[model samples]
Target: MRLEDLLPSPEPVRFVAADGTETPAPAGHVRPSDELLVEAHRRMVLGRRFDTQATALTKQGRLAVYPSSRGQEACQIAAVLALRDDDWLFPTYRDSVALVARGLDPAEVLTLLRGDWHCGYDPAAVKVAPQCTPLATQTIHAVGLAEALRRKGEDGVVLALIGDGGTSEGDFHEALNFAAVRRAPVVFFIQNNGYAISVPLAQQTAAPALAYKGVGYGVVSEQVDGNDLLAVLSVLTTAVQHARSGRGPYLVEAHTYRMEAHTNADDATRYRDEAEVTRWAAADPLARLQTYLRHRGLIDDEAVRTAEDEAEAFAAEVRTKLNADVVADPRTLFDHVFAEPTAQLVEQRAQLVAELDAGEA
Candidate 1:
């Protein structure tokens, strides 16, 4: 089939307006239950609190660096909640919110950000890849893992997360092409938060939408309101179901905004106007979902207070754990890279050990 024939219109799928009013989903799509919506809201609130704490830690030098997903909680929470426990998630540095929501310990998730190790937790234990630092490299890993699952007759799918900046990487294109051709059970989720670091989306690409890139590879693609928790959950649920059913890979572009700077290291004001940030602040994901639930009588003042209390408790736990000093084992540097250490690596390890011994002496 020609690429044009497989391409769908770039219209976004949304089930809730910014004002918290219900909107009609496309045909065959049903609105989620109030129970599920409440659960999703709880996760989003926790994610917001987690992001806030992590950013504060960066400021206090408790964390080396942090990329806060302040306004994008809905996208992070919904993506993980939509998946089964057996499914794998490949996250980027900014996806700590998603990782936390997926049952990873908050301290473990921040281990790498704390500058202790490359990976804080085992990928095999939690079915989550190490939070990738290099741009778009995880996409290829996700595709390869999904293809391997298919070969092994395993019942699983992979959700690969990337940022707007990552979409520009060559690995992004290659991974998408390979997945589409191989019919890999993987979903490439691009969180387009309007800027690639300081560079605006207009500067990123002239394509109608990032999801359109999936169409070029003959992969099914959809766009959704990243701020709307319900909409993001619905869209991701459908995509995951499609992949699990042996359909080709899917691409989802989440239209969201980064409320904070790209990282604690960036000054967003250099590139974006305060007025634009103010506009997105008004559409804050956590507030929108809370408003929707309140309007539906699914959430009351008491429930809101309970959620807040829970978030506070989580933040406290993260703070206490992160404030503790971490001891580094120098030997770990030589571990896990290869079954047998290379001669050069052995030499480097010995030199480091001798230097440490001399200093101690």
Candidate 2:
């Protein structure tokens, strides 16, 4: 391709207006099918409910911390739904919503945050990396994994999910550079939720758009209206196809918002005014998509009701599981750390086993 083709447009790729009207998209950017959109809508609904349940659990002392993705449902769900099951997902700590949308058990998705043990689910089994906490670090891991997959002649594409603030990290830059140079099959999906903790986007980076950051690395990039599910799904579908075809890595920056504070521990009122929150709420992803589908007659009242019921049921199941007593084996600490246990780990496991035996005696 050409150098000019690597640059992202200043305006975000959009298909649905904020008011639920269908808009025209650029020629090559195909709108996702109706069936996919409806399924995406249901998952988006379920994802938001899951996020709410997790936050409530945090407040009830059932969880340690929850970085809610309340307003970013479209980005969270669309990112996972766009990929094939064989494709890999590298998620950030706040991406539990995305993890659940990817069909991971909610309880297992929260294991790390709950402080129960290491990654609750096997990364290899599900194609999802452990939910990473440090900013932009997962991008490097995603790139490395993508390169390994490429070297092994696998068809899997990797998508690394990040927040806007993570773009400032050195790892994020390094990953983009390496992936671009090596033509790795990775897509960097940035959820520009307007803040890194209390820091707003304005304070984070002066770049016209985070998508533009990929240009210097020669990675093709795109910006999308993240609140519009149709737009997000469309852009990501194209990005994944571009990477899977061996063209190189792609970068996507979704312009979205975080309605809730950074986490339950954060005081959002100190940094942002209610007026800004109210404005974004007017463009809520769930409300917008539901309106669009209803207008198109794609989903009827019964369909909407069924989706709500499913979401409620999903939340209830998560709550029940989290409330139940946990049975954990201390020996698991030494497991999953390596494919083959090192001598030191073997020695440490023996010492722990002896201590447990003595305590029981």
Candidate 3:
């Protein structure tokens, strides 16, 4: 087939509306089970609760800074639900919600914000990479890992999550090109939250959609309403199927809105208008999903109240643990840098210990 034929077009697929309406999935697509739907809702609630706690802790000076995933829980939960436990996940710094959905603990995640080690577990243990801060770099790492897995005859996919601003980066392009050329088993999940730390998506690209960029590298792609969990789940399921079936990489542009500032250190109001925030708030995923579920008689006031209570309890527990735990040793920072510490690193560790003994910062 021609390269153009192999590339994904810019058309979008949507299975839900902003007003809590449902649309049918494609004929071949399968609907998720009720159990999965309930689980998805639980995960989203937990993620939002965790985000709220983290933000409060940041404001109270318990954490360095926090990036809220306020309006993006559905995006992460849906994408994560579409994956198998064995599939790998590469997440960006702002995607701890996605990591949480993939079974990462909230207290362990808060450790990173506490200025401790990268995270509490081996990334390979849960098949989720450590959250990458240098935007878009994880794309390259994900592609390489997928390529290695493919060579080893493994039957799993790698879902690489990135921001829209990352789409403009060379690493994004390089990863897509490499994945396409090698037919690596991976999915490029672009969370286009309309802004990259105050830079709107329009400023980052002139393309009609970020997913269209995949066309340049012959990767199949699709765009969907990231706020609609059902829609995101459908698209991600398709992408996973494609990768598992040896169709190589797929690019998924999840159209979401960032309801909060980029991070605790950011002031989004300086760049975005209040009217825009108001508009997006009307389409809030959690509210819309609640409306839909209630309409379907699958949820009630008591159920919602119960969910709220459960979420609050979970958040409180995490906060208690995070605050009560003893601070990690500063010396352990040098331990994970290398499998075998270099002479220079050994010297650096000694210097750090000496400084600690001297009661210096």
Best by lDDT: 2
> Model 3 off-target regions past 4 Å?
2-11, 24-29, 347-361
Each model's lDDT comes to 0.90, 0.92, 0.84
TM-score of 3: 0.93
Q: lDDT tens string, model 1, 1-361?
A: 5675455445677777888887776664557778989999888888899999999999899999999999999889988987999999999999999999999999999999998888889899999999999999999999999999988998799999999999999999999999999999999999999998999999989998998888878898888889988888888998899899998798999999999998988998999899999999988988899988998899999998898899999999999999999987887789988989999999999999999999899
TM-score of each: 0.95, 0.97, 0.93
Runs in model 1 deviating more than 4 A are 1-10, 343-361
- Model 1: how far residue 333 lies from native, Å: 1.6
Point to the candidate with the largest TM-score.
Answer: 2
Report backbone clashes per prediction. Answer: 0, 0, 0
Worst 10 residues of 3 by lDDT: 4-13
Task: List the candidate 2 regions with Cα displacement exceeding 4 Å.
Answer: none
Looking at model 2, the pairs that clash are none
Residue-level error in angstroms, candidate 2, position 170? 0.3
Model 1: which ten-residue window has the lowest total lDDT? 1-10
